[model samples]
Target: MPLGVVIRRQPGVTRWAKWVWRAVAVLPGAASADWQELRREGEAVEYHAATLPLTVYRSETEAYRIVLAAESPSVFVVLHPSEEASPDRPYVVHSVTVSAHEAQQALDSGEELVEPVPMPPPLYAWLADFVDRHHADETFMKRKRGPAVEMQSEDGKGDARIRQAADVYRSPASRRKGELH
Candidate 1:
């Protein structure tokens, strides 16, 4: 089950203030709540969203591990367009996650204005359970290369007999030319 978190932000006052993102509150497991307007410009209404359900799956265990191992483990609250497709309420909560690196990358890439908040214990436990259920341990098998062949083919040219395209692709000259060998 996905639990919801209400993310709140206060509007910036100075000119440079708009560039910074701050989280006011994170209400966990909230069913529903009132919508607060974020900003207004020429009748364009943007609302601050409450209650974004943070979800995780077993398939994301590796990603969760990376997130948890980060120096600053945090939950990111992302904003997006509303579900009903209304011009008035242009923004809503898109997703929330514990991946601090992902959140920083999203900000750096200009994907969205994400708010990073500290993950509460309950929410962390919830995500841990999801990952535990969905995560699978994958085993890797070492691949053995074919037995060493005579460097010199039947012909004294020292070049491999061109039986397939891979021969040309794996040629030293081709490899030097930046082809994958």
Candidate 2:
């Protein structure tokens, strides 16, 4: 499915960063856009950043279900720092995904910014259909433990086999106190 990322650029609170960019919303089945200005208010500007394909995989239906079950079902948009960043644009839309896990991986990188855009109504329906058709219930299998091996316990002693000394628990400092110079 084709998805458009809507980014809002606002004046930064800090002097270092002149402007801050964030993904505000996503447009499902939206036409191609390239930093097209959508709206302007005061110093804040909203742009249709880019249109990227939202791909769903059968194996990732569980992740999709987790996202869909949320109170506000969201599609995660990943943005990476653009090497060719100008004063106007600093980040590039990397990808869009329905799987929360995939989005989480992108977030864990710390380098990329992951924005959760509310899932569109039509996109939600399409995702629900895809999950319903491809998702399979996986059975949980309890892991069996191997036969327990009896081992010797040296409860107040630190491996007696290493040293048969009676003051095994005593510190080396104590031994030094009793030593003759």
Candidate 3:
């Protein structure tokens, strides 16, 4: 049986919209019947896979937080090619994660479908636990520049000796443009 995560969404208002997000529950032990189908293409299809509430750790992204605060919380669902035999199509996704980065990596592999869906919550309690375990308040670090290298020899001049080179800098008119090319 395909595993499922039941997410419940609470109704509310936020400064950015008529609805606010709350992860009210998480049933990790859910059955396939519990997941909602989001979209499908040809033989491939995508499901709610799981409810993983995403979080951003660095403090500098307040604007990002504002955007999140204004919107509903969501989960990333990853699709994989189904193992079962299909006449035309090849795959389906049955897994999910709360990490958008991971979902995107799966999608970028060009082998499966992935999506982000607004989590309806049974997520509240689990969300708290998720936060407690994964939460991070990170600080941004600026990259330091490496030491610059001298373009020439230590004497500040090129050391090569071209004893036999003809005038390579001669005017180009003598050589046909096509030949030069």
Candidate 1 lDDT over 1-181, as tens digits, reads 3435443333556887442234544656666544666555553334445665566655568778676666755678776645685633435666777765557667787757687667677766766676677778789989989987875544323346555434533435433454334
lDDT of 3 by residue, 54-171 (tens): 3445432433333234366655555565587452223344565554456657888997666555654554345444455554666799999988875433431233553322334433
Residue pairs clashing, model 2: none
- Cα RMSD (angstroms) for every candidate in the order listed: 9.4, 6.9, 13.0
Q: Give the candidates in order of TM-score, highest first.
A: 2, 1, 3
Instruction: Tell me the tens digit of each residue's lDDT in model 2 across 1-181.
Output: 8999999999999999789899999998899999999999999999999999988899999999999999999999999998997878888999999998998899898999999989889999999999999999999999999887755433345665655444466545445444433
1 versus 3: better TM-score goes to: 1
| Superposition-based RMSD of candidate 2 using all C-alpha atoms, in angstroms | 6.9
lDDT (Cα atoms) of all candidates against the true structure? 0.58, 0.89, 0.46
Model 1 weakest lDDT span, ten residues long: 1-10
lDDT of 2: 0.89
lDDT (Cα, 0-100) at 144 in candidate 3: 97
Give candidate 2 regions above 4 Å deviation: 144-181
The window of 10 residues in a row where model 3 has the poorest summed lDDT is: 18-27
